[model samples]
Target: MNPTPPPTIVIVPGLRDHVADHWQTRLAQRLTAAGRAVHTVPPLTGERLALDAQVANLAATLTPLSGPVLLVAHSAGVITTVHWAARHSADVRGAILATPPDFETPLPDGYPTPAELAHHGWTPVPREPLAFPSIVAASADDPLGAPERVAAMARAWGSHLVDLGAVGHLNPASGHGDWPLAEELIATLESGPALAPIGATPTGEPG
Candidate 1:
């Protein structure tokens, strides 16, 4: 008989280009080095429908996996993951929503405007608790979403909150390369009771 396969680590990136030194890329590489299967969604062009389509495609990608799946999403990726979970919660085991942007706030020029955010079906951001275990990590100084806003999201989603403290979006600009704490967080999810439906207690320092 074949040994059980390791869980797939789905890496979902945010908008625009995927930088080489970004923490997400580095984490993917580290997971790969540790013998995990990593699948990263291709960068979307930021079109409303296209982004929604990407969420649907994520469901398709998970359909065939035999083992549980874990999601590691950053920025807009966090939004995408939450939307995907609202529909396809059964397929995911856990998620790490790091530095998600607040759609209600004014975004930088060239990013999705408030009208576009609504048009793209990203508004009324899913606040319902996820069907699986999740942890929402927010930077204390993130310009995208205030710490309180992020914490509120975590509470609404029934997810544990992790306060990263001044790490801008937890991206490369924050100077967080090869985040070693990720492994510990991932391990926490993996070792959780596999059959439990409810999530674990909220975790991390207050954001």
Candidate 2:
């Protein structure tokens, strides 16, 4: 008998969409070079802030794929995954959610305001535990999401929390390129159980 194949990698970008210097883009390029199946969700050209549209796009991306899928999401993309989980069911094996911004709270000057997020159907994030295994890699000093708040979100989603320390938003503007930690985390998630949500809440601090 043949061994089981690896899951397809699905890179889900944030509100800003794909960036040439983004770590997700780099990971996708590297994975494809290594003969791994990889796909990145295309950014919406219109209705950029509509959460429903984003969810539909993600679903459409996954609809044609066969076998298991591992979602690698960042920033608003993490929120998009949770929203997708709430309404849709697919062959999602796992997810790596990095530096998810807090939509309920008012973001910084340049980001979308809480009112805008609410009006666009991004606020009131889904708090139900996810059906699939997931890792929420949060930054201690991320300007987008406070540590405590993200920790709470991880717990609500029944996800394992990984403290990424002070990596800002883990984006190109945050000085992160080709994030090697993501590779390690992805490996762990790949070999992990189907649903590994920790029963107890963690301290939410880096040990």
lDDT of 1 by residue, 110-202 (tens): 677878887778887989988888878778888789888888888888887776667776776666666666777788788775422224333
lDDT string for model 2 (53-96, tens) is 99998999999999999999999999999999999998888999
The pairs that clash in candidate 2 are: none
What is the alpha-carbon lDDT for the whole of candidate 1?
A: 0.77
lDDT of each: 0.77, 0.88
Instruction: Give the count of colliding residue pairs in each prediction.
Output: 0, 0
TM-score attained by model 2: 0.93
Clashes counted in candidate 2 amount to: 0
Q: How many Å off is the CA of 15 in candidate 1?
A: 1.2
What TM-score do all the candidates reach, one by one?
0.86, 0.93
Q: Model 2: residues >4 Å from true position, as ranges?
A: 194-207
